[model samples]
Target chain A: MTIKEKSEAIVEEFAIFDDWMDKYAHLIELGKELPIIDEKYKDESHLISGCQSRVWLHADYVNDNVVYTADSDAVITKGIISLLIRVMSDANPSEIYSSDFTFIDDIGLSTHLSPTRANGLVSMVKQMKLYAKALYLRAEK
Target chain B: MGFKINSIRNDFPVLSTKVNGKQLVYLDNGATTHKPMQVIDRISNYYMTENSNVHRASYNLSHIATDLFENSRKFIANFINAASYREIIFTKGTTESVNLVASGFSDIITEGDEIIITVMEHHSNFVPWQQLCKKNKATLRFLSVLKDGTIDLSELLAMINSKTKLISITHISNVLGTINPVKKISEIAHNNGVPVFVDGAQAIAHANVDVSEIDCDFYCFSGHKAYGPMGIGVLYGKEEWLNRLSPYQYGGEMISSVNFKSTTFNELPYKFEAGTPNVAGALGLERSLRYIQDIGLDNIFKYEDDLLQYATKKFENIKGVMIIGNAKSKIPVISLNIEGLHPYDIGILLDQMGIAIRTGNHCAQPLMEALELPGTLRVSMALYNTKEEIDLFADALMKAIDMLT
Candidate 1:
């Protein structure tokens, strides 16, 4: 899917507004819909720190393309994790390197999070994309 | 389990207010307590009527402010049953207080020394010592908590060695509500020739704390957690240890004689105080303490005890609501996850009903890992909390769980 399509999907996923509770339920539903990663991608190295939730995320290089898979114990976190995997998972190493996550602003995301939580979410995204970038660099060499 | 519920509810403004057009039920006291009417008035009065810098000024306003500030220290010292007023040092909150000790006590941590902590400490207590040990080439040791959430005393006793420098334990586990026997732990640490620093952030609000009874080298707590204003807290250090540990910060008011040649520090308390402190915040804390004392700590404790027992029974009756940290000696807080429901979702749904609860790890990441579960919904209790609030929480939680399932 195109980046615009993926971004729109995320916004649609979070569009529920009955309350923060329903909002989170929808997020967990989004996580439930996350496409599975290949079994080989599950390993020890991809876990994110600073989250009480255990999230293992991995990206792979196939035919000069990157695909991502992630899993989390907490459904709400998993939904965000799914959104993250969709946003930064696939595409070229160069795109991964140069792209900014500025689209999150349009979705009115991060506003609900405290400063620390928002920063932690940023760190999680950064760490994931950096991992994908590493794989891309290795293949190019 | 009932004790003048309606009148007590009115004392806390948050309880009287409506959220999303619904009555507010606050069950997040472990995070922080909602201030009472008197405490609120005291804080407002300070800003409106008595706004002045404290100490070292020879003016009337300064003298009054200084008296208020010092009186606050005496109030808190008396609240905790400390021997003297000089024992209390104010900081931003419990986090800063713990960091102060970790940073200051680094002056004595010889190479190859160790710091003993428990697995259940909030990151505030854990990370500071981890950083300190790492910086000083010392080993950081964690005494483990059992499945029931209580620490194994024998195991911790084994961990203490000649190299063990300090035992820093949380008096009450924020996430689990597990109350550690600090007096016993302090005894063991003292036996091993190591001092103990008790983090009383969660305990001070719920239980009576006598620093002399605990007999530890250092103790720390926050005023916010005890129905007071935020951004101010207390650090109680033994006089000998306070005299021995170097000051963490350097600034005005902390110095005695500074000449062109060199700078000399002031005496105890002021030596660590460093700067002109939060005068109003300190007084507000003093008021909060008096409020607690007036309600009678024993009376409040008994009331909360009834509420927690009622809550536990009420929660257990709800299908698929599983409580965590079933330690025999626990405070009122309860962490539980509904079968197949996320804690955040539950917290959100409940918030819409004008009920406030905490979700996420509650800042005990390591304990979450050990539990092998995601974050749980934490229903923490305060002395002012009633069984009615717990009923509302149970009703909302069940409703949320049903929606999720």
Candidate 2:
């Protein structure tokens, strides 16, 4: 599915749960299903700073598309990162740079996030886009 | 509970707040405390009528302000049983209090000198000494805590030698809730001819603190933690030490006289206070101290101890709940984690259920490293908290755990 289609699908899935508990349960399930990043990529270099929890994210370009894998010591953070990875991963670099990424707000994730977690989410999105831009520039070179 | 806790809790207006359609169960006392109505009213009264710049102003308002401000220091000095009111120097908070001492002691702390602190100190207590030692070419040594979170007293005594110039330690571990034997520690430091600075930020409100009884050279604590207003803290130094140590900051109100060639500083207390102080905060702090005194420290300690025991038993029985900081002597603070469950997840879930708890390293990253934990969910209680709140917290935590695991 396209990045927008994937975000819409996730939003629709979240809409099924009326209770915060059930939504978190769904998030936890997503966390458990998150594709584990390689042990080598779990180093400090790939770690995102300023998060209350530790999140290690790694991205690589394949056929001009960015493939991202990430992990967090925190289950909720892991679940949240999975959303970003699913939406932006395997998308064209230009598409990632141009995408509005309104699914976070549509799913009411931003409003529910604590200030610290909100910052972490922003950093994750920023990192994903930076990876795409770098790969696009390298492809040009 | 010996005291009328329900009535006492009513004095705190924030206790009646509802979060997410549930009664607010505030358990983040270690971060800061909710002020009583008396304190809030006192602050308002100061701003409304007694509002004026303290000292240097020849007016009725300034006189009233100065009287209230100075009386606040005197009241706090008496509250802590300091040697004299002159020994009490006000600062922004505990951080600034420690920084003042660390900066003032720089002249005496020379190259090859040593400073000793514990592994469980909050960053406020740890960072200043660490940076001072680094800048002064001194070695900063840490007394390791045991697995159960209590500091190794014998080990700390052994570490002190002629090379040790100063010893600064926390009276209570913010994360561990371990109450260190400051009096005993002070005795050892004095025997070694070393001055001791006690960070009483966590201890002052929960228990009675007497600088005279402890015999520590210096004691510092924040007013907010003791149900006072923020931006005001107390630093009690021995008269001799206060006289010998140079002022950390130089500005108005701290100088006796100013000249282009050389400036002479003011006397004790004023020498340390370099600017227009937080007069209203000081007044509010006095009112807070009065409120706590009315409740009585012994009574407060007894009530909180009972609450801790009950909560500890409840949490101990919960499956998958691992209670960290199992110190034999502790206050109501309890840090815990569930097997395979992140602290942030538990904290957020509990907040949704109308309970407030602190998560993460709590500004004690080195302590977290030593304990080998990413972080913990800490439920710290104050005098106002009751057993009912603990039950609600446990119920919410269990539900969160069930949902996650």
Candidate 3:
């Protein structure tokens, strides 16, 4: 699916929950079900240190598409990472680079995305886009 | 006068507010406190009526502003039992206050000179000395913390020698809530002919601080942490020490006379205060200190101690909940982590439940390293917080844990 389509689907899924409890519960479940990254890539080289939590993100260019895997010490942050991965992973680097990811605000989880929150999600998103942009430029070269 | 919890809570207008559709239960007083209407009104009144640059002009408004600002210095001196108001130098906050002293000491410290600090110090107290030592080719020693998060004075004594020029320690550990024996530390340092500096950022609001009684050569604290306005802090030093050190910043008010050739520095306090000062912030801080005085620090100490004990007992009952700092002498701050849960997760979940707490290293990374953990959730209480709020917090924590698990 396209990045926009995948984000819209997740937003629709979140819309069924009326209260914060249900929304958070869904995030927690998603966190538990996240595709675990390889133990080797969880080292300091991939580490993104936030004041509140730590995130490790690894991306690869394969079959002319970008594949992303990530992890966080905080489950909520990991859950948010899972959404970003769902929307951007397995897409072309140009498609991933151009994607806005405004779905975070649309789904009412914008607070977690704030730079002040310092959960590493904001930095992780930036790192992901940077990876895509670098790969796209390299391929063009 | 008796301690009136109801009226005290009412004084803080933010207490009545709600968050996330639930009544707000603010337990993050360690970070910064909610200002009372008294302090708020004082600040607003200063900006409203008495807005002028102090110590500059001979105009009526400037004189009024100068008087108010100088009176605040006097009030703070009395509040901390300093020898004189001239010993109190105003700065932006505790960070700047510590940096100011550190900057002055850079000239005094030479190669192989030693400076000792505790592992439990906040970064504000830690980084300045570290960088100073690094720059000057001096030695920086850290006094280790015991398992109970208390400092071992014997270690401190062993670390001090003729080579040791200074000992900088926190009066209270911002992360561990360990209240050090400042008087004893000061005595130890003085006996060894070394000057001691106390970071009283956490202690000034929670406990009674008598700088003369402590006898430390230098002490500092932030006003925001003590229920006052931000951007205002106090640095109290011995008259001899203040005279011995060079000025940290060179600017307008800090000079007696200036020319292209050279300039003469101002007197004790103003020498350290360089720029146009935060006059309104100083006034607000003085007013907040008065508010604390009216409530009585003894009463605040007793009230907060009871609350800490109550919360500790409640937290101890929960399985897998580990209280990080187990010091016998602690203020109303508690750091804890549940088994198999990250502090960030707990902090986020608690916020959704309309509870505010502090998580992460609490800006004491060395202490966190010593404790061998990522971070712990901290709940710091103030006089305005009540038993009911604690009960609510306990319930919300359990619910958060349940949901996470």
Interface RMSD values for the candidates, listed in order? 3.3, 1.2, 1.6
> lDDT scores for all predictions?
0.82, 0.91, 0.91
Best model per DockQ: 2
For B1-405, candidate 3 gives per-residue lDDT tens digits of 779999999999999998888999999999999999999999999999999999989899999999999999999999999999999999999999999999999989999999999999999999999999999999999999999989899999888989999999999988888899999999999999999999999999998799999999999999999999999999999999999999999997999999999999999899999989999999999999999899988999999999999999999988778998899999999999889999888888888888999888899999899888999999999999999999999998898889888
Off by over 4 Å in 3: A112-114, A134-141
DockQ of all models, two decimals each: 0.30, 0.73, 0.66
Itemize residue pairs with steric clashes in candidate 1: none
Candidate 1 stretches greater than 4 Å from native? A1-30, A44-70, A77-141, B1-3, B339-342
lDDT by residue (A1-141, candidate 3, tens digit) is: 899999999999999999887898899899988998999999999887553677888998888898999888888878888989999999999888888888888898876433556445567778999988887778779
The stretch of ten residues in a row with the least summed lDDT in candidate 2 chain A is: A109-118
C-alpha DockQ for predicted model 3: 0.66
DockQ ranking from best to worst?
A: 2, 3, 1
Candidate 2 chain B lowest-lDDT run of ten:
B1-10
Please report how far candidate 3 places residue B143 from its true position, in Å. 0.7
Cα lDDT tens digits, model 1, B53-153, are 77677889878878888888888888888878878888888999999999887888878999999989999999999999999999999888888889999
**Considering DockQ, which of the candidate structures 1 and 2 is the better prediction for this target?**
2
Q: Which 10 successive residues of model 1 chain B have the least lDDT summed?
A: B1-10
Clash pairs, candidate 2, are: none
| Candidate order, TM-score descending | 2, 3, 1
